[model samples]
Target: MSPTQNIVLITGANQGIGYAVAEQLLKHENYFILLGSRNAENGIKAAAKLDPSGKSVEPITIDVTDDASIQQAADQIASKYGHIDVLINNAGNNNEFTHYWKQQESKEEIKLDLAALRQIYREAYDVNLFGAAITTEAFIPLLKKANAKPARIVFVSSHTGSIGLRTDPSSEFYERMSRPSFPAYRSSKTAMNMLTLHYAAMFKEQGWKVNASCPNLTKSAFTRFSDLGRSPAESAVNIVRLANLPENGETGQYLDENGIVAW
Candidate 1:
């Protein structure tokens, strides 16, 4: 694919790995980067930094949790860009991580506050899982409009979501996790993987490419504790690499910086 032939949209592009990806993509001549953020202020600020003259980097308001917001953003993108070459679903949240774990412990790991769990699930699933699904559904039409190559969708994911890595006895992740039922965070990512596969299978059958990627344990403000993790800029390398894959590249698998992660 030509460097200028793609228009890339990255959700949660205000900071962290998303922002880093924006920074890197801006350096590539002819690639238009849409910086998606919940906050307009942060979005504009990030866009300005990526494109000093505000020509290439376009700041767009998008809250993955809010359907109305997502629709509005989709409408705008459809009208302005006509086609989206690539989409990176990077928006996510973990606000209810601590409480859900505490309640699960109180229930002898058997029960939880259904209301609270639903609320937490709504936020996490909406952003990490459902948001990506909606974005894909909304923009798929525009993607097909692109005459260059099959539209690509890259789901930015985590190793925590890997059931294989979580259950492995010798894996570092299995040893480090403290919560027994911390499924809210981990499961949301797992759901993301499944969604990636669902799209991958469908796209593959239709001869299109869609994939998921794990940045590993990247050090960022999002996590309360992080050791042996790379900086946001460091982690962004793999995400960018996967996003820019050739049309015929791999899809429907979980990957990290080095290569594929088992299941």
Candidate 2:
């Protein structure tokens, strides 16, 4: 690693917007990309393919649902780099990509299998929301070890998690949506946004950049039947932009593709 090399760890980076963020960040000569995936083989394969030049990408196994895995990864990074420049909590779950509307009526009228819902919620919340929080706790020591200033931590969230947008009748996504009763995914991300705020407040006392980002409704497998709008490459822009910001960047704010979202 160069003296000025910056290490960036991105979770759930085997595919989708996570992969795109890794790909885009590699253009910078100073970045050492840590591709975090539950599958070690997939992470290695993605690292090899995305960073064929081999100087940028480094694959690391990280199953966010597993506390042991998170601790192991954090320990390795802290031992190797002494500090992490950026941490992108990009991993999320969407209820096995089930079409909630097709399965049931409204969130209130739906009669989902309690066991199934709990199972999905356990994995999704453990990984999507709590995973970020645990990772932040484990890595804060390394972040504070910086020689000069504090580092950046980004939570890759979605607009579907936004309370303001979800409740707004006049908004563009009022009736055409199908987000019925599946509180696991949406609620997990809502918790993620709050987790972002909590971390941001903690880091603000130490002068670090920690914020949440709703990457918008990007074209991905997560969208299910929705029209493909923005590519993962495009969606990665908001996050990487946040990741690469200078020390003066915003913190504790929820941002979409355009600007801040009302909490």
Candidate 3:
């Protein structure tokens, strides 16, 4: 890789938004991507599919839910590349969608399985919130060593995390927003948004731009190929732009395809 080339690591990149973003970034000559996946085989296949010659893309095995896995990946990246220009915390879990919807669909006598709810919430935070936190903490030192000017960190957050939209009476989601609409998934992203700001403030003096991005509703495996959402490539547009932000670009903000999203 050239000195001017940027080394970007994206978690959960084997498919969906992560893969789409990798594809988009690879179109630019200076971007080298590390496709992070929990499965080594899947990662290798995804990387090879992106770049058969293996020039710009490399697959990495990383499970966001596993602290040891995240740490090992960071160490490997540090050993191989010395530093990372960008880290996209894209790995996430929406495992509670069914439970949330099921609970919502229940009539007057809803059986609340507290234990089950707790399990799903724990799973959601494990991958969606805590995993990203752990991974970012593990890689902070390497990120600071980036050769690229104004190192960046992008949190792949969601609009579902917006309390304003959820609470606004006129909002389309308002009717179903009262409760149990994937609260675990939504709250984790909310926490992630706050996390983004904290990292942004902490690293501002260090020339690191950190921001949260909402890809909107993207139809991929994550959504069970829901027809209501846009394609993975379409949802990837804003994320690609965020990843390419300049030194003077906006930070500590939440963005979508068009512009800034309301907090």
> Lowest-scoring 10 consecutive residues by lDDT in candidate 1?
95-104
Q: Cα lDDT of all candidates, in order?
A: 0.79, 0.81, 0.88
Displacement of residue 111 (Cα, Å) in model 2 is 5.8
Clashes per prediction? 0, 1, 0
lDDT per residue (tens digit) for residues 1-263 in model 1: 24455788899999888998888876643578889999999999888877887767889999987889988998998887777888899987876656644555685664547886688777777788888889888878877776546667889888888888767877666776434655777788888999999988877865566778887666776754467667888878877877777767888878887788766
The model with the greatest lDDT is 3
User: Quick one: best TM-score, which candidate?
Assistant: 3
What ordering of candidates by TM-score runs from best to worst? 3, 2, 1
Candidate 3 vs. true structure, TM-score: 0.93
In order of lDDT, best first, we have: 3, 2, 1
Model 2 weakest 10-residue run by lDDT: 173-182
Task: List runs of model 2 lying over 4 Å from the truth.
Answer: 99-111, 176-181, 224-227
After superposition, the stretches of candidate 1 with alpha carbons farther than 4 Å from their true spots are: 1-5, 98-114, 170-172, 177-181, 224-228
Candidate 2 residue-wise lDDT, 1-263, digit = tens: 56577888899999989999998888743688899999999999999999777777889999887889999998998887788888899988777456464455455655558787678788778888888888878777877875435588899987777778777787776553335745677788888888988888877877788888888777777765357568888889889888887777888888876888765
